[model samples]
Target chain A: MNTNTQTTRLYHTALSPYCRKVRLVLAEKKIEVELVEERYWEGPPDLKRRNPAGKLPVLRFRGNLLAESQAIVEYLDEAVPAPSLMPQQPLERHEVRRLCAWFDDKFQAEVTRPILNERVWKKITRSGYPDSRIVKDGLRAIKEHMDYLAGLLETRRWLAGNTLSLADFTAAAHFSCLDYISDVDWDRSEALRDWYATIKSRPAFRSVLADQVPGIHPAAHYAELDFG
Target chain B: MNTNTQTTRLYHTALSPYCRKVRLVLAEKKIEVELVEERYWEGPPDLKRRNPAGKLPVLRFRGNLLAESQAIVEYLDEAVPAPSLMPQQPLERHEVRRLCAWFDDKFQAEVTRPILNERVWKKITRSGYPDSRIVKDGLRAIKEHMDYLAGLLETRRWLAGNTLSLADFTAAAHFSCLDYISDVDWDRSEALRDWYATIKSRPAFRSVLADQVPGIHPAAHYAELDFG
Candidate 1:
């Protein structure tokens, strides 16, 4: 477990879904980390050095630096092997990773990108030209994904499987960001809604929902949601 | 690990980086399974049923289905528990995952995407109008990523650290694809070139290099490179 290793340092943004996932894992593992808010949009020189890809959720451990959310999460899971975020079965683990990738890939591209465009990324990346069509598509995709989640939740208690895992945290991280803009339809699937409510109430999840980005505001319902 | 589960099947495509990562891990672990090639682009109904997200490298284990290369690899590492792909130390494990994520995320976005756009994705996805600018940018990015890899290799024998790990396999899978298009500048970094040759020479890696995608021809250099 490398008990000799000191508390890890994470460079992240308050509003990033990827960062939120890492934060949730850390909190679940009960590992204390020094959180450094990195202004990634500013293209800070130090942040760039921390992450060559110029992405957030970079971790500094024992004079070595690691980047990428998947890597960070897996590392955290392995580093602090308590309450086991990953399933022991190879196939079960695969399902968890697949869901994680799905959230990162399709969900991000179809849902998160659109909402972020309407909300945060539009002002951050400065690419400009936020088309309403994309937002409309994003809104639709969210409902579809939520339906899929509902179906999964129908059989299993959690997103990937029975026990709470990183898969739930990954999904919740994305949903939380969208919820900030009121983009997610909480009522779409009562099962997923209930699952989220349970997740949000977690002590680990509290910090995520409490997170605030400057000049932006979360929807009124965010504070009131109860997935449990 | 699961001799009785030898009926396990790996649903994969020959050209996919994610799929290839799983293959390398399986070979390294010396786990044998029936391989079923799924043409994700062709829209296989069975594949779709197996993975609602419709991705490749879905593992069928004892009537149980799993997905995601990262998840599959972790499962293999844990289930087998010999010649560990991940270090026991939490920080070291995180380092391995962080590098894997780097290749999968940043490298895939910057380097592999460009090559896929120019060489394969267009043919597979039938997406029209490829951007020349993006292809050029991808080629440029590969050189930088290679240089960064060389810096790491200069100090360590493998991509992540001293021992062979999944991190090397992830990098190699992407490089193999790029090598097929003759996109890599092999001579630019002698150290990386040598390290890759060593990995390529592994008995486990032979099948991956021998893979052919019907009409598309691989670079002549692909045949002559000796990992041994």
Candidate 2:
């Protein structure tokens, strides 16, 4: 067996919510990870070898290449078991995973992906100029999402429940991305804004907030804890 | 508090892979469910109340409405441990989840959704004629997916490991939908075909196999045990 330890590395893009989610969880668990930024859009040859899906946020941990953000974070929660990001009961856990999916799948397709594609990725990749119409639609969709989240926050301490969980990190990851581009109208919902502010203040969020992508500048309030 | 028992119910569509996944897991756990077919595309007003995301495969279990197919199934696995679909080890469990994401997110986007929308949904909703180019692209994508799955089944007894897992069911769920539409070219991969045959023979697959969407007929070999 190869006894020498390999460093825990993550192949990711800085702006990706999926990568941000994994990065936040890793930092929360206090696991040291070497973040190697991969320009996945260029279709890096080795990415396919590492993950058949050729997706961003592929983690190299404990001599294994782990793909899929939700899977990786859930595994981290299960393996490390410190400051657990998952709830104890099955029902609670279901709530956590449901919200995680809500942000990653639904929220992403509606708000994050479209906005980022038009605002950030297009500029970064030198693909095309930003389309105002697409960005407008994304902005419009986010308000409904904000209202829904505010309703949830009124009843619970965190996105999933009374306890902090992966759902919070997942939501923050998406919001942080949009916030970076100054797309979020924080004034729409106080509860949603407060929830973002609390999660943003965490030590786990430091690396994510510190991110600087060349050619596109983060919004002035993107890294502020009290911005809301 | 009222103590009368409530029936486990699922609001779903007949041809959705997400719904099939939940149905398979429920049946596998021997949990009788009332499958209420929801015409989600028509923008059912109650869908928003059931799930703010307004998606299908919403499960009403234990008096609570549960959404997201993966979350519902994972909760089922945890709540009812008998004949557990998830492995005990954290790494193994991660593998199961990774594959589930692979099928649900990646494969569904590349293969299932595009093909189904073109061939099935367009016809059912009276939206438009089938787009052969899109259908062709989806069919082409499935071959690559089959190759990947065939590679995994080369050594392992199941997709994730040596035992039946949520990964297998998740994959079968997507494949069965494609199979129903006669989109999958099963002869491309022997191992993959054998894997599907074995999983299809399970009692859990009965409900999914019986699914019939009006106006769109299932392929002749869709429900056959010895299809390969």
The local distance difference test score of model 1 is: 0.81
Provide the clashing-pair count of each candidate structure.
6, 0
Candidate 1 C-alpha lDDT tens digits along A1-228: 333445578889877789889888888887777888887787888987877778888877655677888778887687667978988776677678878989998899889976787667776666676688888888888888998999999999998899888899999899888887788777787888888888888888777778777767878777675532
Candidate 2 residues lying further than 4 Å off, grouped into runs, are A1-5, B1-5
The most accurate candidate by DockQ is: 2
Model 2 chain B worst lDDT run, 10 consecutive residues: B1-10
> What TM-score is obtained by chain A of candidate 2?
0.97
**TM-score for each prediction?**
0.91, 0.97
Tens digit of lDDT per residue, candidate 1, span B1-228?
344554878999877888889888888888777788877778888887887877888887666777778777887887777768887677767778778888888898888977787668787666876688888898888889988999898889898899888899988888888888778888899999998888888877877888888767888878565622
Looking at candidate 1, what is the lDDT of residue B18?
87
| Model 1, runs deviating above 4 Å | A1-8, A32-34, A61-64, A124-129, A225-228, B1-6, B124-131, B225-228
- Model 2 RMSD vs true structure: 2.2
Native-referenced DockQ of model 1: 0.63
